[model samples]
Target: MDILDILLSASFWAAAIRIASPLIFATLGELICERAGVLNLGIEGIMVAGAFSGWIAVWAGLPLWGGVAVAMLTGMAFGLLHATLSVPFGLSQHVVGIGLTLLATSLTFYTYRVVLPEVSSPPKIEAFQPYEIPLLADLPLIGPALFSQTPLTYAAFLLAAICAYTLYRTPVGLAVRAAGENPSAVAAQGLSVTAIRMGAVITGSGFMAVGGAFLTLSAFDSFFFDMVNGRGWICIALVVFGAWRPGKAVLGAILFAAFDALQIRLQQTAIGALVPYQLFLMLPYILSILALVVMSRRAEVPAALMVPFNKGER
Candidate 1:
């Protein structure tokens, strides 16, 4: 089919939504961290660890949801380390985040070797299947594209909505945002800046891990090396593209997913015969970079982002 026909197809949209699911989770996690004025660059490694943790847990006989919980806990453990170094200690966030990424990634790889030294290929598990919402799945293009997704996809959307509401409509959210925008104000109000920032990082990292878990538990049945494939970094950019708002960030994820889905389809079309395959691979990232540039030009960053706060000193 041609590009137009492909774009109009229900299956194409369904694929787009499916592809966007993991990104939505990770982007939201990154958004939460940035909103709290911390940048958790460890997301890439955390995702890798999460993917393995969840899959291994399932392989070891945990229920599907149990695997998810294990992944979140694993991510939170890393988040705790990130927070300990960057928040109260007031170290260089960039350095700490990158270091955490290396540590987590290496540790995960070592554990994988230790657990299955003789295995040539990663083992497979029963991944999540698509769950079609009754009447909603019966509708036109929108139905299958939006309603017929794995449970994790639904959770991603739900989490986005909850994040938006919490950031804009709740008192606790106010404190979190205040901690990012003005830590002194948060401290003045008797809320601990260190506590708020550390909490945000820890919680956000859990969500990031769940994002990784989605890859293993929903998108694919088996885990392998480089499965995450820099999606973590993409989610970071998506957070900036969405201006750190959950709803907008979700839209950004879908947009990128659409680009990705389009490129895959394009590679199978008549035009695919004449072009280099690498171009097809680059299409989504090129489009995303252009979009990011346009969106970020107008995006407002949190005033206190990446700025360490030492209580009683300022």
Candidate 2:
């Protein structure tokens, strides 16, 4: 198809949203952690763990919801691990995060092989199907793109709103922000910075797990080692790319998903042959670098991000 044809297709937009679904969940989760002054790089492994945990739940004859619940619980466990290491013990966030990622990824793959063994084909599970919204599905272009989505897709959109409200409204939200900006001040005010950070990290992880679960449970069938690909890393970048705002993060995610969708569709066309498809695949990452450079100056990250707080120390 031609350029205009590609841009105008409702199917294309719908595909973009689908591609972005999981990323949004992960992004919001990370956003919460960062806003609370803790950077959880354990995100990649958490997602893999979630993907593995969710798949295992379904394999055991549990429903999709049950699998999701399992994934969230698994994610929370990891989050608590990160919190215990970084928040309570005052460990380096970078080391803890990277270490967790490696640990989680290794644990997942080893378990997968041990449980199922190497086979010609991996096990498959029933996945979620697209559910059309009755009234809006018929609208010319926008309706099909926005309204006609799986329940997960709609929930993702709703999540953006929920995140926006929680961070911008609510007393607990203020405490989280304060903990990020100035923990000593929060501590002086009788708010426990440790408690807020731990809560944010643990709760945020559940959302990240949900994102991973979406991959095996909805985006595609069966669990594959690399199914998560670099989506976790991309979610991390989008947090900065979105300037830590939910609406902006969603926008950044959609933009990345659009390019991702374009590259996939282009790879199938005659134009794809004229240029290397690998180059198109690089668009998202390339934009990530360029966007960070351009957006970094204006980006407002939490003041204490990646810094550990020791209650007894000044």
Candidate 3:
């Protein structure tokens, strides 16, 4: 039709990519942790924690990159806590993660009220600007539609590819995989399972933090109570959908995000009056359950996931 129609049509895909951005980052982060035989169910909490930390950092005059760095550090701290509980104290991984999530929820709310007690309106931070490559951004149809996205979107794509390569190609990746599969066997070969686990947890946290930072600093330009909005759980579901493969997880993230974007657009269209918004909101979870049901028979989960390892006991 006209230029307005073209923009509307293209906006659908663009919005999908935008929604996918955070999910991809968070899902890939969860994939890394899970692949290393650790089930950190705290992904959602860590994400919300990072969202607030990053937002506060930005509000305090730190550069946007600084905010991201602080968010990563916050995630790392939580990872350290998680590792301590599950790895050393022999606590239940699921329990520890649930506890962490609760702690994060409390922490985010406390900080929000304490810091902005009198502010009646929500506060915002400056979001990251899109950086478009001139010639490429000008290309026909797909080019501008894809290349004109926020920087975080490109970073998510690159990180997914890199994570795939790291998990399947490199020696370090091999060590991590081996540790997850058979810790005693790996340790007998002189590799430190604990060390590998620590590294994976930390790295995973960094990725998760970036996912949170992207939400406040790029997607929404502000932090609100529970701003992550269960995205962390969505990321965990994505890992199952992707079978813990980085590339597949990213694709799943895109699909989940597409449903989310579609729901938002539908809310604004004439069809909104005919359909229940709750059904649209529930689409991602429904897809996730369907994926789990279909893939359970075929998916290969890490053999030792969530099992605590003790050198002497082995």
Best by lDDT: 1
Clash pairs, candidate 3, are: none
What is the alpha-carbon lDDT for the whole of candidate 2? Answer: 0.89
lDDT of 3 by residue, 53-161 (tens): 8888999899988998899899898888887787767689899989988997788889888988888776777888877867887777656567888887888899999
TM-scores of all predicted structures: 0.98, 0.96, 0.92
The predicted structure with the larger TM-score, 1 or 2, is 1
Candidate with more favorable, higher lDDT: 1 or 3: 1
Encode model 1's per-residue lDDT on 148-244: one tens digit a residue.
9999999999999999999899987898899989999899989999999999999999999999999999999878869999999999999999988
How much lDDT does candidate 1 score?
A: 0.93
Error of 2 at 17 (Å): 0.4
lDDT score at residue 4, model 3, on the 0-100 scale = 44
The global C-alpha lDDT for each of the candidates, from Candidate 1 onward, is: 0.93, 0.89, 0.82
Q: Which residue runs of candidate 2 sit more than 4 Å off their true CA positions?
A: 118-120
Model 3 gets an lDDT of: 0.82
List runs of model 3 lying over 4 Å from the truth. 1-8, 267-271
Tens-digit lDDT string for candidate 2 (282-313): 97778767877787679888998987887858
